[model samples]
Target: MPPVKQQPCPFAPLIFDDEEAIGELSSVVLQLHDALSTNGRCFTTGATEEKAAATRGRIESVLLNAFCTIFGQSPFERFSDIFDQASYLAEHMAKDHIFEDGNKRTSLVFALSILALRNVPVVFPDNPDPKSNPYYAWIQDLVSGKRTREELAQELRSNHISK
Candidate 1:
């Protein structure tokens, strides 16, 4: 008989550390990028990825581990480590599809948490009216495999950022 194809594990929730919960929380944002990328999606905040089986699990584990791995010494750090100058971390997390569902929302919360730590509040752009919002259209472009990380970064820096 042919080999059995195992279905993807979909559970992989991230846990936060007491000392570094802030940065660890940001990891979920990155995980969102992994999730979207798994579904072949991108983000307007500058996140994108390619489709791959190994990529999903790897990102999930990394996200779960981010608390301990990267924030051991710096708990109150910034989001630049993951996002760098391009905000690719968001895309990386979304594309991987680390979780079974709701990865994008989770990531958004994660991003806001980072802002919160800095005393900067964030609100969802699409839900401004609480109804009939097109905020999530960005994910559709990625899920349909229409964009890449590089493309997203350039687009964000070019059109989204106001100088």
Candidate 2:
């Protein structure tokens, strides 16, 4: 078969040095999950609340490992850029498939929420239907490794409020 075409990634990696920040991230992630559940979007496949909380805790641990450092060393002290942080949340949440339903939608909302927390004005193409938007396609491409994280970071930076 011909080589599969790669799509551009819409997120970049981030690193963290603060436990409080990690806690904040975990809280945000849980809040998103709860919100989805309230909206009838999240289905845990019959998992109990304790099980779900355990799963979320595991996710938080993984996130911390990916984004945090034990010592405030030279390379570890730097946190992920805002764009990268948002992208990481979006990509990982979607790719993990933790929720039985609406994982992608949840991921998108999480990403946007991260941006909003940073006071970044997120701009999207004026598309009424998400399935019809190129941005959605781009995110899929990113998840499939068709696009690089650096490219996503550049795109995000270009569209950020600072731009």
Candidate 3:
């Protein structure tokens, strides 16, 4: 009998290094959805639930596309690092305003989730108040184009988990 060769995958491997990381991403997405839907901390104005779900779908699509070597778009640019990818995700999600509300929170959550999946520990201010958290304003700056992706990446690097 002759040996058989397997064909390469049509798309590039996802940002995740392994199945566990992929699973973590899935779990975080679900968590974000639930937190937004019921937490009352982040709420959408008109067509709230539907828009929230839509945003979730969009996030899933973006993550999937990040794996594609050829056809993928958005955060999957060539020679980009994980920080750049995270910054892209965060900026677009907030700027696009996919939801009537909570876009900023969702964007931050997605970015942090991506980092966490990559084993990057992102430390925010100890203050639980959003107004007191510098990251909130910083993310807004990113969305508004006042800040560059490199700036976001630098911030992430500064706060990287020592482990």
Candidate 4:
């Protein structure tokens, strides 16, 4: 008999300390990228499977392990909070150049989705001119590594409203 395909859970707890759970999170990231790539968004012109392979590997290795630390005998949590984890994920996705295009766009959407799944919706502060908003500069600082993950998490907390 052919094996039944398992569906990835979009609402799973933001856990990433183990290999198995990390694998699941990696799948979710890829699913997100796939959904965004063909939408006339950040995807590069003439994108190919070969380009996607690099992104997939980044998710499995760097993104999934961003919050992990080497303990005495095993890996341990560096950022146990979900917000911090989301920040790291977005940080790497934005700055790593995992995809040839849409790095910032994809990272922001993925991070926001992770938060939205937990019933917290981000509310961008009101700015008359969206192009001149400080939030964009803040995100740029994050992508450039000028802002730490903890700082990003705190900012995210401040910008969210309970839903």
lDDT tens digits, residue span 109-162, model 4: 788777786666779853634367665556678877788878988888777785
Off by over 4 Å in 1: 1-23, 26-86, 112-124, 128-134, 154-163
Rank the models by TM-score, top first.
3, 4, 2, 1
RMSD of each: 16.3, 10.6, 6.6, 8.5
| lDDT-better candidate, 2 vs 3 | 2
What's the distance in Å from true for residue 137, model 4? 3.3
Global lDDT scores for all candidate models: 0.42, 0.66, 0.65, 0.67
Model 3 residue 77 CA deviation in Å:
6.0
For all predicted structures, in order, the TM-scores are: 0.38, 0.68, 0.68, 0.68
Q: What would the TM-score be for candidate 3 when compared with the true structure?
A: 0.68
Poorest lDDT segment (10 consecutive residues) of candidate 4:
67-76
Q: What is the lDDT of residue 82 in candidate 2?
A: 65
Ranking by lDDT: 4, 2, 3, 1
Q: Which one wins by lDDT: 1 or 2?
A: 2
Per-residue lDDT, model 1, residue 130, is 19
Candidate 4 local distance difference test against the native:
0.67
In model 1, what is the error at residue 15, expressed in angstroms? 18
Off by over 4 Å in 3: 1-31, 45-57, 72-79
- Tens-place lDDT digits, model 1, residues 40-61: 5444333245533344446545
